[model samples]
Target: MTDHAQEQEMEIEALEAILMDDFKEIDPSESGVSTTNRCFQITLSPQEDDLDASNYTPVQLALIFSHTEKYPDEPPLLNVKSIRGIKTDDLNMLQEKLEGEAYESLGMSMIYTLATSAKEWLHEKYGQNVLDEVVEEPASTKDDIIIPHGEPVTTETFLAWRERFEAELALERAKLMPESALTAPKDKRLTGRQWFESGRAAAKGPTTVPEDSEEEEEIDFDDDFEDDDDEMLEHYLAQKSEKSAEESKN
Candidate 1:
């Protein structure tokens, strides 16, 4: 193979490995780099906390990368496709920013750089504060619907809120229950006694306490021990009183 062809193959392999490691999925039809041509598409998802708790719809975007024959020496063409929840102007701005980034990375592997830039742009444009941009009007008919904090109240919003609340509540309840209780049939709710019984039955391991240790023996609160304790307490009190008296006098 020619030196340029080998270089192209090596670069393609490195790019493929980067994509596989970074993204959960990539379509081969949309991603490839060869001696003659190079093109790839990557889908970027918004962060988990990007949407308002009530907003069920998530924002996603497909970034298509097109490279010239002189790629790695020249910048790649970046196009935004399948965009959701962002304005056209915003997307244009993102494209401009990415183009600038590619130009800045003149002679380096630019695929990972482009992908990282796209993700950061998505977070900035459509993350947790997305609702602030959506509900621009001062008032609307949808205002009457009560929603959870950081979420707009709609049918989907209410459902998402309920799901989140239930998940958090279940976690709290699990904290109070024994580990053995978690193994019980989820559909069957066990009473307090039943929970105790299940836990007791599951605990078949040897006892942690020593069989006949002196520490476990009953203590004798006899007069001699009590007298000694009282004397020590009196001595401590006397010393404390003397310290206080000296400080007050000073």
Candidate 2:
């Protein structure tokens, strides 16, 4: 294969790794697909205290990636295949923002950038404060107004929303507590400190030492001892006792 072809393959691999690592909302299968004709769906949900939590529902978007035969030399195409629970205006805004990103990031890895831009747009447009104040009036057409236009609230939706809200609340509470108090495990898994220390050590570099070598280092301590100071102390004490006895007799 040519150098350009090799570079394109590397770019695709980089994109795949990024999606797998950073975009946890994308499924494993979806992230593993070939980048030649990449298409996948991703879901974005707001944090519990997001301004529009009252009308918040998860937004799903289908992403399509197109790359030229000379990929890294040319910018990839990112188009939204489908979007649910987002208004047409918001969808258009997201597309515009993505197009701007693609143009700005020409000759660079743009797939991850495009996906992150879309996520930001979703949060800005859908995760805003829509129910800030009570407006008094219009009792007749109150039912006609939809806070979030597309999706209706059902049992399943409510349960999903409640679960997300509670999880976010727990996370916030955890943040407020002292680090020592946040030691309880939510599941049978590594503790937070263990995870952090492992990650830190990994970042620092390799830290493997042979068991026998470590034991040898631990046992190599000095064993010699001296008692000159003790002898000196005893002589000083005997002299002091003689002086005190002579003083008492006088």
Candidate 3:
């Protein structure tokens, strides 16, 4: 595949994976598309087995935003069709962003926004039920059950932990990020150097140990006779000093 095609495929696949595993609550399949709990609904048209937004009706196009470019910050672009009644302000904003030579060259990001806007526009023009499909999950059975308490953490638990960690890391990252960078448009995200600096600052923060705390750590000496001998010598010297003082008094 060409670079454009490859990038599109990767984006689609990545979106599918995120929707299926993370957004299972959305039930993308209810709209006649095949999907797991992850919101990415796979569809087949004529000879093809997957969705191609270029082929979808204006309404069907809007639903694509549900899973594929689900985030408000990172939207997908659809090139095939345009919404009929987009607000003037929205249009102007989009035009301004598109006019940038930089955005024009970043075809993937541009396409993403197009696809995402198309999805939302479809829902607005059509109705919600237009995108709803029957969502069916497999019936649960005891066969897959290893008792939770007795078992090591399940895949779900590990995934949950990872998600929590990611969220915490994100909060820490945000804390370290320049306020200007944080408020900038999504496309104008922090550069690699900024990210590295923020990450280093984040990594260094909560993990720091205070000097007093370090000093308070009990010294762990070796369990050898040398320590015992040192203690004995100190006691002997103290006693000898006392006896010598008595002799001096005599």
Candidate 4:
């Protein structure tokens, strides 16, 4: 109905598109504040690249806000909550920082901007090795220690590791190939290891039918029958030749 309302509507749509599952419209009562306007919350986490650097405790937080009746003219009411592995003091500090930014960002759609700031802060504060200090130690490492790598290989995982090793060696040799050969390769090549990933691999050895297979038995039976028929024909021809010779002699 008003310019402020129109701006809020557009910003909400943009945030929903960008944040996907992380952004959601929450009940007004969830804000714990008496308000006639819409309230919403955004889940925030540290950026992904930094999280991959080392073992770290997962951290998350929520940025909850409500538009005032005259949003954009007045700053939105903001709050921060520790969703995971965040301390109370951290939430207070973030709340004050976001509220200050809200005032500074008055007369504009500030929720998305505030969410971005919160995410960046989360990354800087908790990303990489910084989270090691806050990560919880296992109750017992001797028994309860989780595997750091992936699922362990089973007996059924008869991988052709030798082929993969040879392939890798070949790849290394290929790297040392002539400059002209490298420039225009004959075919697209993928390593055996690459092919063997994710349970989708070719059989390691040549495919073989079982020794007790009925197909092989059936083939052997047909061959034996053909051999017997040939022997009978040879015997019959021999007898006919002998009889013709005796008749000619008489």
Q: Residue by residue across 1-250, what tens digits does model 2's lDDT show?
A: 3466667667667765755532323433454334545334444443333434325445555555656666655666555534456666666677777777788887766676777777666657655543333355756564443556777666788999999997876564444344554665667444433443444345458746787684433321122114423333444466568889999999
Model 4, span 98-194: residue lDDT tens: 8899899888888889998998888887765455556576676553435679775543443666667767776654543335545654474433233
Off by over 4 Å in 2: 1-4, 21-57, 129-250
Off by over 4 Å in 3: 1-9, 19-59, 62-111, 128-250
| Root-mean-square deviation of every model | 27.1, 32.2, 31.0, 24.6
Clashes counted in candidate 2 amount to: 1
Q: What TM-score, computed on C-alpha atoms, does each candidate reach?
A: 0.41, 0.37, 0.19, 0.48
State the C-alpha lDDT per candidate.
Answer: 0.62, 0.55, 0.44, 0.70
lDDT of 3 by residue, 105-192 (tens): 4434343344344345434544344334324587877557655576666679889999999787666556545577888899988953
Residue 210 in model 2: shift from native, Å? 97
Model 1: per-residue Cα lDDT over 1-250, one tens digit each = 2354455557667767766533333443554323234556676756654443334446777787766667677876667764466777877888788889888998766777787778887877677665444555566564586646765557787898899997876565455555556777877766443443344334445336676776663435353245543343444456568889999999
lDDT of 3: 0.44
Worst 10 residues of 3 by lDDT: 40-49
Worst 10 residues of 1 by lDDT: 27-36
4 in model 2: Cα distance from truth in Å?
Answer: 4.1
**Best candidate according to lDDT:** 4
Top-down TM-score ranking: 4, 1, 2, 3
